[model samples]
Target: MSAAAPYAALSPDVVLAAVDAAGSWSDGRLLALNSYENRVFQVGLEDGGVVVAKFYRPGRWSDAAIAEEHAFAIELAAAELPMVAPLVIDGQTLLRHEGYRYALYPRRGGRAPSLESRDQLEWLGRLLARIHAVGSRERFVARTTLDRATMIQAPMRAALGSDLLPAHLFDAYRHAAGRVDDAVAQRFEAVGPVRQLRLHGDCHPGNVLWTDAGPHFVDLDDARTGPAVQDLWMLAGDEPMMDALLEGYGQFRDFDPGELALIPALRAMRQVHYAGWIAERWHDPAFPAAFPFAAEARWWEQHIADLHEIADDLF
Candidate 1:
């Protein structure tokens, strides 16, 4: 299960060795967790305990940025929010082994949240408002901010630089994405200044783990500073669901109706960002295997058309 270069060096032996180094003696049992941007594993320990280890993707995040992420998680958990904060091993959350940086988190299990459940939606919303409340208390000095430049412009450059984009479709792709960028810019302009707060930048259902006790959030790796809507919109499937969420959200904090306008723009930016991410990381075998269609010219063609259609809809 070795990937290219840096990740390729992260073998099972290396994983166990790293865990042992973290003072958690591995019992030689490991299960791969659902992760892409980084390598995550559930390793059993001699004490009959189990923990999840996340190996940071080389060069993806700087040490300072990652430290900020860990600090934020610790802050949220300390606030009594249902957050999975990394365990501090040897007085350090970030550890190095075999030239790779990684972290250990207490293994917490749960099933995917039923987004259709009104109770669940309300519950999620309440917790989210609290998370935002804590988030507003401070900001990340090194982590990313969900703005057009980072989410849209940077991804565009990454995708364009990749060889996967068909030469014939290059202009079409660029033009369509450009339109999305432009529309999103205008949308932000109309919305005026927004209160940027620390957010679980990628708060879709997949990132949420649910159990009878309640819901706890995982994977703060994508955490960033952004409008509160960036965290809310992804959790709601439609208008009714959003209403239900806001119903609970109102219990804790005010929800800005104006940020609602940024939803469409965020959608477009995510669409562009997703493709760009795959393009940039195509060198990783897991990405190509997971997103085979990215290699197909027809997909790019359709992606270009979809981008244009999204732009048209924006107007």
Candidate 2:
């Protein structure tokens, strides 16, 4: 497809033409399946095989980020971790056509599991443990980790200062919320208490697929070295859920209580970031209804009222 063509119009001919440009793709029927920040299509070839074609949006990410993801996938596969191995066509790790980055992965057959499933949640914890163990020092990409002040306060202050969010709300909550900040800092200072490891930076429900073999992780876009708990921080609340996650991981080492204590803080930060992004893109016609982020914003406000409640709980 030409760079000018709407990414949705990836016909068999278009798919072949683009693939053939690299002298790699053939006889594939491209199907529409993805609708998010990136363009994705599923290609079913005449040979009875299928692959996912992705077209990335350009912004904070450069073409090199796409290539790094390809390299990381290879490294992860080499470590025998369960994941989708990416194909590199032409001299590019990802196909660049029409000014967008693209790549294909063999389709894995699986069902989407409910995010609330204890079994799946536990399995997810273990899966993250295994992925983090995949050693890397290639400096392929910037690592993902918990940097509370930068990831939370600085951007939040900017957002509030921009007059995009209600300044009064921040002012009303700031003093009470200061306790969360102090707690977070204290935990970080006593770093001996948290379990640190590599992480799948964005291991939400969608990134995980349930297959007969087990759970296969997809989309290593945010993969990075950081605390293993980063994978589960967003999945907090509820005792059974927390227990299941830790139990499924099947092993324990010294965990920093400080790192785990940051869960509530991280939760609030994620909701703020997500809601702000969605509000910024509210004019886009394709935004999904899956995230009720406005509700989350309200929840954070309420949680801030009792931030001290989480001061001692690490689970």
Candidate with maximal TM-score = 1
In candidate 1, stretches whose alpha carbon ends up further than 4 angstroms from where it belongs are: 1-4
lDDT of 1 by residue, 67-95 (tens): 99999999999999999999998789999
TM-score, candidate 2, is: 0.71
Global CA lDDT computed for model 1? 0.92
Error of 2 at 215 (Å): 1.4
RMSD (Å) per prediction:
1.4, 5.3
Clashes per model (N, Cα, C within 3 A)? 0, 6
lDDT of 2: 0.60
The C-alpha stretches of model 2 lying farther than 4 A from their native spots are: 1-17, 20-28, 114-122, 135-145, 153-197, 235-237, 250-258, 280-284, 288-315
Give TM per candidate. Answer: 0.98, 0.71
Candidate 2, residues 86-176, lDDT tens digits: the string is: 7766555677655555787778767775658877777776765566656324454544455666455554454445433445566644554
In order, candidate lDDTs are 0.92, 0.60
